[model samples]
Target: MTDPAIPLGEIVLPCLNEARALPWVLSRIPDGWRAVVVDNGSTDGSAGIARDLGARVVHEPRRGFGAACHAGLLAAEAEIVAFCDCDASLDPGAAERIAAPVRQGSADLVLARRRPTGRGAWPLHARAGNLALARMVRRRTGLGLRDLGPLRAARRRALLELGLTDRRSGYPLQMVVRAADAGWRVEETEVPYRPRTGRSKVTGTWRGTWQTVHDMRKVLR
Candidate 1:
């Protein structure tokens, strides 16, 4: 049966050196929904793989996750915009859940909460840090979000109305906080999260983690 909640729109994938996982990610997407892949200066052939898999590719030279996401969002020509990491951690079917609230006109933004599907999926520190950040967000903005996970869906108009300015790595937190501050109806849904295909950009490296934290701090203020 056709999902009544799935919006007629496109999904945007922001990628960097994700050639190995692109095909798997593309294959999981349901038919009738198009995808736009934003290649953020990938040294590998991630763009080529995406193109071969029938995804429209956009090149963004800037090396920031937020920048890539913003570029993809602007390029999307759909009413509802879904964004996911190209690493395949998020279940593709969860897109329907994320878009459901928006399609029903009940929420402007839907954030996915990631629950580890198996052992050794998410590192201990990362999980703890994410929970702490979520708590902090709830305390500051009075908006409870389970996870600022990469899997998310929102109305394009509502996203634009939030006036997102952070073009760095902290884009996810910035987006949620801004949406809450704008009084947008935000909802959360549980999504299964598995380990990615390649090395994690943020948690795998200390430099990446530090940079992410710094960027997040800058945007939180």
Candidate 2:
């Protein structure tokens, strides 16, 4: 049974110690859309802040990006499920535009192509890694995707049907690979990428970026 209170679409925010960014992130969610904040064992009071700001907080004890993302997906009841980082690196409001294609039955998956709005918004190492992955994706799937970005939207039922198994950094790549295999229509739109409020947990350091690339490469293989 669908809850009438539940909106037609919801955005899943995977949070890890993002208390400082919650207020801005939650406030920017499109009107009439629900925000599901999945707390991935944050030592900070991220969960409380999200709840206080009227976001539906789901606790994901597992400490991985995919784990938190999947937890939020499971907690969401909306027809459209969108994902955005809780770090405030990307605008949640852009979700409305990216999700429109899915809602209108024009695309099965929609990803945001991040165009950094500031000089330091995107780290050089992270960008290089992302570019390499995107090229690999194009070669493997022929999707013509420019970025394996965090801001994305898809139908909840269809996304679950993809049977995503990755519970780590490889999760997003796995989603695209599986979607390509399933012959799903994937689309991309440009969005402003801003500097995050707090230090990034992943892709903020050289080692972190390497680990992320390694995790994703395993999926590619």
Candidate 3:
């Protein structure tokens, strides 16, 4: 029951030193879907790996996660765009799930809520932050988000209409808030979130955690 409005779109993966996991992530993408990999100044050969795997490479010198994602969105030709992390934390096939609501014209933005399955995978602090952010988003925007996860899909027109302008680590939450404020139809899918292949840039570092919280609060305000 694939939604018909789900036009052929591009998948954007933001990579920063993800050489080890890029191959697996790229390989898992379903055929016929174009991919754009934004290399956020990776010292590793992540951009090269993505290019070799048939992804259109976009160089984003900026270090922010949102910057890389925004670059990919601008580079993509597809009307519908999907953004996901390059750490292999999400299922590639789940793109279909995100696209379903859009295809049916029921939603313009589809966010994947991570339902962690494996033992001791997601860190406690990260989980707490995710839950707190979701609560704040629901309270502030009246948009119920199960999680502020990386895997999400949206139509280009809707994204632009929402003015999704977070060019930093808190981009996910910002986009959701803007979409809600703009009255875009939004949906959330419960997808499994696995442990990433490499060290997570945000969840694995204290500075990143603080920056994420601070930026998210700004977005909320």
Candidate 4:
């Protein structure tokens, strides 16, 4: 049975050493909503902070973005599930935007576009690579997606039925690609993006970007 304290929809936060940012992220969840934070083997005590701040913490021993995200989905008992990163780059309240379309029956999936609020919000190399990759995805898959953002929402049943298998940085990419090919109604909304509290695990460095791109390319094939 779903917990009564958890409202109609739930938000999942995949965390990897994001202790400093949990307080800010957890504080912004809309009233009556629930947050599930999946700790992806963080030695930094991120799970403790998330628990203290009222989020249900699910420890995922595996240390990959997709693994944590999948664990969060498994823990979620709500009918609607939204995924968000706990890097403090995204506004936690933006859960409303992601959930609204699905709740209103207008769309099956929604992706949040990261509109950086200031300089340094996104890296130059990441930006260039993201543009090229987004174009490639649109041309090949025809999803009309602009960003492979962490802040996204969908009916839990629909998401799980896609049979997603990627468990790394390619996880989100696989979700987007599969959903598009499955004929899901996907949409995008703009959300304020700020600088993250700590160094990015992906999209902030050359090595991380390379791995992400490589993994995503593999998923596309």
For candidate 3, the TM-score is 0.93
Candidate 1, superposed: residue stretches over 4 Å from native: 1-7
List model 3 lDDT by residue over 1-221, tens digit each: 65553437778998899999988888878656777899999998998889998888999997888899888888877777888888988877678678778867888888888888786568787887778788899899888677886888888766766667888977888898887877888888888888889888887765666668888989899
Off by over 4 Å in 3: 1-7
lDDT of 4: 0.87
lDDT values of the candidates?
0.83, 0.93, 0.82, 0.87
Candidate 3: C-alpha lDDT: 0.82
- Which window of ten consecutive residues has the lowest lDDT sum in model 2? 1-10
- Cα lDDT tens digits, model 4, 112-136, are 9888898988888887777767887
True lDDT of residue 77, candidate 1:
75
Give the winner by lDDT: 2
User: In angstroms, how far off is 191's CA in candidate 4?
Assistant: 0.5
**Model 1, residue 47: what's the lDDT?**
96
Q: Write the per-residue lDDT of candidate 2 for residues 36-75, one digit (tens) a residue.
A: 9999998899999999999999999988999999998889
Model 2: lDDT equals 0.93
